[model samples]
Target: MTLYGLVSSFYNQKAAVHAALRDNIDTRTALEELRVLVSQSNAYIAGRKNAKLAPNRMLLQSIALYLTDLLKTFGAIEGAEPIGFPVGTNGQNVDLESTVMPYLKVLSDFREGVRKIAREQKVTEVLSLCDMVRDETLPELGVRLEDHEGLPTVVKLVDRETLLKEKEEKKKMAKLAKMKIPPSEIFRSETDKYSTFDETGFPTHDADGKEISKGQTKKLRKLYEAQEKLYKEYLDSMQNGS
Candidate 1:
């Protein structure tokens, strides 16, 4: 089996076993997480089919390694101690052959089939495969796989685009909010656009700069004037009373 095949199978088996044997553990949740990881791993491979990364084989290898690592972790956690598997065989004692092997074989078959189809078929096929494994096989294996409506996996697949768009939208909304409600200017501009005074006895004509509308400026001035008047009136009343 291919490395990808092996890795996917390893996790798939562990999840299945945990679901079967462990009554106390939330096997359903565990299976769902494993399924999502495998789905994402498969999607990565699908992307690498015609990806343009330099030394692209390294990319695929890296993904395979990541998958292997995840599977190894799962195997360790789930206590995938093999029963009849031979020792000194160099394979992990993680139910590698009996439970994981058949899943690997199925994945290999799917990969070969997809390879035969057009390059565009890669994503569609991988997604379809993920759905199939989650829906059909997980049920048969008595593992409860949650239906996130493919959202979690899609987020992983298109993470950059989605994250960038979300960031930009937040920035745009913040910009709009800033425009609606101005922030206090701590530092003045080098050349104050509103300043009419010119240095070095120069006659610098000023064009009208964009300022707060006349109505807003008037209201602010009125508010400050009212406050000052109220303070003065209060002082006068105190003096008279004294």
Candidate 2:
């Protein structure tokens, strides 16, 4: 195939990977998707004789997250996987290629790495490191790993609704995690635009940042106000241990 054709094919495979990871339907499928992604990348990298690539540049939070009993049971952890990414002491951000799973944290990290590589047009270096991680990982899978299916999953795959709810919960937790724990420091609410009309009653902008009819502006503003009130109630309920 021509170099253009080869590169295009490689990226299409990576897109498939992003889709699979974003949905995170099941662990089995995610692994299979990553394996397929890595294979195409291998071919593309082999053809890149013009660039010198460092296969070890990609970093994972832990080898055990892939090759050991962590994914098997994730012992000691109850609901979520670990939250941090791997980075070099030199302060360079590392890739999450070894985090090949359907869990939220792993899936999100892996997806972001793919996005960054595609964004920077630096696929040659990153994809090569992913294949190296795959090489190190597959040996530990042994007979459980299959050619057509993928690794045997150790945990139940939550349904789409549950998964989405969990994703939202993860996001909420991330936002809340930034704040100092309760009662440590006073929290100051950020200013928010309530409507197209600012406090001065001047025609301003809506959420879409466009000027609209007064009627439509009031409608959207009321809707958003109700949402904020309901969300505040939800947070209050959680604080009260409801």
Candidate 3:
């Protein structure tokens, strides 16, 4: 299993033991499972280190050593006496659950620390990939790679012509944004070319979510007439570039 998967198994086993304690159930089975998972994680990291695996070997080893140190502090599992818990005020057994919770919390914090490191590693790798493409590949190919459908894992190449057209479209939108008109009005202007609106300038749609047409546009009430007026205005604006 991957280091991440190994770590998750250890954590899950620990949680199972905690839950067993909370429910006052027999914790023998859960404790056994926790020990087994921890042993497996240790073996996995040790084997990788011994063979000198190149990919993040130090990270795995460090995590394994850290876990070992924490478990040492843990003192022992259920089978051993005094499993890292202080006794009661009268020297009686204290709340085992409360006593043990702090150690588990430290383990949880360590897991989060590992997760933060993993995230940073991913971001660095992505930035390196971007730098490679931008500095080494873009000038050679004279084209840029864009992610397909907002998916970074899937990319499509964009030629100069397509890039220029996209830039021009962006410029047009920027100019439109600067115009002295409400955003709703600007959007309505674009829709007027393709849609039919009523006297209130609302789209000619009914409660059924379909366009409603009483009859031929000219023969109907102000609704159809308004649509015609909007269409004419749209055509004029397009021709005039207004």
Best by lDDT: 3
Give the whole-model CA lDDT for all candidates, comma-separated: 0.46, 0.44, 0.51
By TM-score, rank the candidates, best first.
3, 2, 1
lDDT of 3 by residue, 25-45 (tens): 655665576567767766775
**Sort by lDDT, best first: what order?**
3, 1, 2
Q: Candidate 1's residue-wise lDDT over 1-242, tens digit each?
A: 34466456656756664674466766456656656655765655554433522223553455445545545555533333423222224544344345555565565456445634734565666667765664445444333333332121211112244545555686777654434321222112214433332342221222355444567557645644554565465566568983
Runs of candidate 1 exceeding 4 Å displacement: 1-21, 24-26, 31-158, 183-242
TM-score of each candidate?
0.20, 0.23, 0.24
lDDT of 3: 0.51
Ten consecutive residues with minimal summed lDDT in candidate 1?
Answer: 149-158
Stretches > 4 Å off in candidate 2: 1-197, 200-203, 206-211, 238-242
Top-TM-score candidate index: 3
Score residue 89 of candidate 2 by CA lDDT.
34
Estimate, for each residue in 94-178, the C-alpha lDDT of model 2 and write its tens digit.
Answer: 4332243445335335644674575489566675654433333333332111111122212222234554555568668865654
Task: Report clash pairs, candidate 1.
Answer: none
